[model samples]
Target: MSTSASQQADLDPASFRAIADLAYRESGLTLVQEKSSMIQSRLRHRLRDLGLADFAAYCSLVQSDAGQGERRNLISALTTNVSHFFRESHHFDVLRAELDRHLPKLRAGGQLRIWSAGCSNGQEALSAAMTLLDHVPDVARLDLRILATDIDPEVVQFARKATYPERLVRGISPDMLKKYFDQTTEAGHEPSYIAKPVLTDVIRVNELNLLSPWPMRKRFDIIFCRNVVIYFDQRTQEKLWPSFLNALAPDGVLLLGHSERIAEPERYGFTCTGPTTYRPCHALKSTARPEKQKQSEG
Candidate 1:
């Protein structure tokens, strides 16, 4: 009564929905119903690679402790990391304004720290650096830095290399294009944009998974978790919001995707501003009065 390869390929809709739910819980992303075909297509490759003809057997492999590598592969396959330089323009604009507004007031020992929680490539982080360098004076002397991270090892490596197809440079400003990048041909054919010295001022890319406990104990002045959160389910979003709040400094600001907003910022001590930005509410220090402490003495 074992299912055939074709039978397994035709796994019931329920199974697909279950996989989607698991993915949402694990990665904070949703696989739309239309993506069943996409799931089947991609998982089929994993099935073949694992030598499992049936989807049930593949699912079993993914669930088993011995199959942890396969599970990661499944996650990598499902998560889409399509990001570009200045993909959402207003956010960067806000970043520039914030830098202009905050740079001079920062304490001597305090540095400007920003996190691009799901930075796919290095573009967003680089863009942030460029903004700071352009707007803030002596940015290098200011102890400013960006921590950019992504779940995918492939993209992380790409970010490390900091190379991209020449066509990807369309949106980059001409002045920045010339100042920060070197245009060169690699392997004697394709054009590549390589990072120059200016980029050294801005970003440090890391391999990070947002759903997992953050390795960073310190807080960031600003965190950009845009577009990425929308993929997560409401429950996961609820859990993540508090973690993000905790990761922010007393006056830290969080910039979320334009389409996303916290349902209850007051619960997390986050006060909403505009559509999708949040600031940590500064807690007033309370000192107990002697009279109040002795209220029952009378």
Candidate 2:
């Protein structure tokens, strides 16, 4: 075949629609018409990997029963994994407040659990671990655990590795960077840091699809489902609210990304405690609020 004949064209409209439909059905990801070009850009490698000529063939496989496993690959390719160490400092403040209220329980061998849903690359879960250790130096010996889950297995594996190159380590302060991570350098390569075992010990990295029923039996004390559901459409977002509401313990706090919010959260069993922060409607007004501090990057 000539070079021009062999070259793949842009994702055709039918192929985009088929892929979009599969993504929505399997993972609740919304792939709109306007984003077709971007979606194609992301999935082109899948075509190359399968030795396919175009998106159409790729789409065909993913929609079939035989493509069940490939559906996960499609979702992984489409899902966004952008994250930072202390992306929003206030959430850690909330963690500190919760630790204050819940530390006594932990000391008594009671449980305190935090869930970092969509924990792209481990920073969020690691940040929560840092906050916990800062509060109780021997927290790893206690009943506290951080459950970090993502739909993408690739990012889950990365989170498990708990290593970051310099670029990915941007949001961490030098003190925190030193305290939590150990720097490893190789010849002619940028220094990379990995989370010390103490930091990762309390963190349980798992592959979880938020759309699937949660396997965890224990309700969480704080749930950080941040910057995750923004890709989901309104109906999909609403569907997740009830699960989160049910997943939280009484007086439990739920924190969303600054860019995400639930309309009429009260109707969904949540009280607006702060911007994108919530408490169960049945909880006391002051459930997890320790003291208000002006937010700052740490």
Candidate 3:
């Protein structure tokens, strides 16, 4: 084959289309032609790991009925996992306030749940745990837990390990880092930190696809779905709004990435309570306007 033909065959147009369709069907992720080169680069390792020479064969395997298992790995490779401790610091502030508000009910034997939806590598959930501790040092005694979930099983496993190298944890303050992380490094390796039981003890990690049906019967007090839905197309995103709204307690808050917005959240039973933050207003499914930010009830 000519060099151009070989290059085309490597990530053939058909293969690209197949990969994109498979990703959307399996995980509600959107792919466009402009990103084909980047997708090709990302999946090249998968091809090699599977002992394949090019995208065509890899695509064939992943798109077939027998390709069911590989679909997970394919989505894992395609998904982005950039995250840090206490990203979008304001959300942590909101968490502090919410935890404080719920302290009374929690002390009275009520449960408080927070979910780090699309939680990548555990930082977001850990950060929430830290925030909860900061707000109420005795929080572990209460029925409180942070569910950290991601579609990528590998990343979920990484989160469950609760270990982080220096670079991935840059957002953590020195004092909090010292208090919450144990230096778990060996003599020859670069310095790394593992979340102490004080943090991890309150967190549960699981692999979950946001597009799939959620198994939790209990609604959450806070849902941090930041920087996640941006990967989906408008229809996919809109479909997610109702699920998130239903998953949240009536007065519960939902936070999104700075760039992500539910096109008029009130339409989907949420009121913009803060910057890219929302609270369920289920009563307003039809004619409710965005209400003024209401404080969480104590």
Candidate 4:
């Protein structure tokens, strides 16, 4: 169908706003007026699946109390989850370097925690696991684990399954692929690879909504929330900076998308150490600010 036909025949402004508001409230995803056409395009599948005639009916259902269960479907349709193994290579290099420095401490029975917030389809978390395994072969035996989470439960389940098609595994080196994944071909399906127990054993997949309160009790030594914040507005993004800071252990590292940066690092008690990489100010004693100063600076 043509774009004009879809927009004019399906959704009106009121219905689009309703969806945008729901998305923002539930998932912190900012769907502004400019996204009206895109929103209509994305939600067409839902309308077809439900046998709805237009966006007005879809909106009525989603906004009513009876449509609570459909909200998840709405989010799944609207949110994009384009990711791949080693999507951002430099972050892995930095992780490897950090692990090298922390090797002595890890060997001394110290605990290490890494959180892959907004971990879509488990690539980011799995990449971290691969890096750790490459640097510290004994990571599995140590008190180390990667917490991979995404708001989409379906993707979380997919991550737990640890299987990917040949296309998705293209960037992974053959040596690493051979070491970490096992080839499998179903009777009628295309050839696929599944992560071996050695790799999957050290990672935990969870379905979590970042907008909601975090349930974990421990702080993370490293956090990978790359590219996920782009969907949120600046205000929503600002609110998350403090939460991420508080969740990170002192001296912990926070890795962001290539285009994402902490707007005011000093205010959040973070200092840029590398491109899209930050460390808590407390980690740098010399640069630590007084509580009063920090408050005033923010």
Candidate 5:
């Protein structure tokens, strides 16, 4: 590819708007004008792979009836998947502290469901699995499971594979790493580690678009949707709050990204318990919004 031709592959204004609209309608991801360059950079490979010369041709193909499958490809290309094991440590700490109360119920065969919404490459879900294992080594045999879902099928597949480069496991503690991961090397391939069966055994990874209807019938006890909603505009975020609340069990916890706040917690029947952490108002036995406590970093 020549330099000039590559540079010209950038999406034109019309094409950019069409893509942005399609992305929002399909995935609830807000692609503002400023993201045009990012879209161009990310999807430029699609043009090359399809033997197309410019963004116009790429746009036409994606917008046509035959482009249905490419729509998923487009989402996988544009979505960000930056995640690491225990990226936010405090949430796990809180979960650890609270597990005592939940363990007995779980031990008694009560179901304990946790959802890692937008679980990119399985780190967050795996981290939760490790936490559970730390407190209850037999958690996998109990009625406890973590549902890890991402909009990108590629990332979901990566999560299901449960393998990671050595560097990605840096945040894991030495003791935990020894217990939960098995390091291995295949000739000619980079050294990597895979989560132990104990971890993978209790987690289910699947591709799910949050904008579409959820097929889950069971509510979650804890939800980790960090950094997932920042790509959505306020209106879109507002629309999601109710669905999240509905998905959460009574007294269930909701964890959001540091920058993502529930704009109107009371409007969504949520009470802020800690930074980026919320509980349903009904669960607290009060309709009034509680005072916002200082949030811990997670």
Candidate 6:
């Protein structure tokens, strides 16, 4: 392609918005209006690599499924899966507290299950693993498993790798860092950081599309779907709440993003324990037959 033609391949705001809308409808994410700049920065290289003139044609190719494997690549490229270790610190604090309070009842058969929805690049999963180790004795001996999932397959692959640079480990507690991370150097940089054996104990990284059916039929003790629902419109959030509730065990705890909360918590049978945290009503079993039970004598 000519230089001029190559330069023309970059996705413009309108074209990006169109493709984003299509992806959002397919996936139930609402890319913030301000993300246009970030989107352009990220996709410019993809457009050039594909030799497509501007985003409109690229989007057309994506929508048409023109190539054998471009559609999935396109979806993966457009989706944002930004996250860091201990990204939202408060949620982890709450998580530790909840685990301490409920660990005994949940420790049946020496097993406990957790899920980190939208777990980008496995930091949160590693954090969960580290946190579990801190609170539970012989943590490696416990049958603890965490399911880390994201819609973006590329990120899932990266999560499987479980490597990170020093910058990504910022704000992580010093003791946890020394204990869980293996230091290494980058190609030209002096600093290097990566996950140690601690990650292997707790995280199970896999691909999962939140808008679609979850493969895990089993309920979880703690489900962390943080900073994920903010991208979805309220309607989408409303739809997802019930599905999340169904995925939870009777006493399961649900953690949402700091800014995200259901306006009608009662509809989902969630009781607010703190800001942005909820507990599935332990008394209201999903299978209970209220009408069939007789009242006791007064």
Per-prediction RMSD in angstroms? 8.4, 3.4, 4.5, 4.8, 2.9, 6.5
What would the per-residue lDDT of candidate 4 be over residues 83-125, giving only the tens digit for each residue?
9999889888878876776677888998888999999899998
**Cα lDDT of all candidates, in order?**
0.75, 0.86, 0.86, 0.85, 0.86, 0.75
lDDT of 1 by residue, 116-222 (tens): 98888777787787777777647767668789998877778888888888777777888988887898887866898887766755688888889888998778988
Model 3: residue 224 alpha-carbon error in angstroms: 0.2
Candidate 5, residues 243-267, lDDT tens digits: the string is 9999998878898987889977888
* 167-280: candidate 2 lDDT, tens digit per residue: 998888898889989999878878899999999888999999999999999999999999998989999999999999999999898889988888877778877777678788
* TM-score ranking, high to low: 5, 2, 3, 4, 6, 1
Q: Write the per-residue lDDT of candidate 3 for residues 67-130, one digit (tens) a residue.
A: 8888898999999999988899888888888887788899999999999999989999999998
Clashing pairs in 1: 28-232
Query: Any idea what lDDT model 2 has?
Result: 0.86
TM-score: which is higher, 3 or 6? 3
Which pairs of residues collide in model 3?
none
- TM-score-superior candidate, 1 or 3: 3
lDDT of 6 by residue, 33-107 (tens): 677777666766667788766778777777774642675666677676778877677777766775775666556
TM-score, cand. 5: 0.93
Between the candidate structures 3 and 4, which one is better when assessed by lDDT? 3
Q: How does candidate 6 fare on TM-score? A: 0.85
User: What stretches of model 3 exceed 4 Å from their correct place?
Assistant: 1-9, 282-298
The pairs that clash in candidate 5 are 275-295
Stretches of model 6 off by over 4 angstroms after superposition: 2-4, 7-14, 32-37, 105-110, 186-190, 282-298
| Candidate 1 displacement at residue 113 in angstroms | 0.3
Clashes of 3: 0
TM-score of each: 0.84, 0.93, 0.91, 0.91, 0.93, 0.85
Select the stronger candidate by lDDT from 4 and 6. Answer: 4
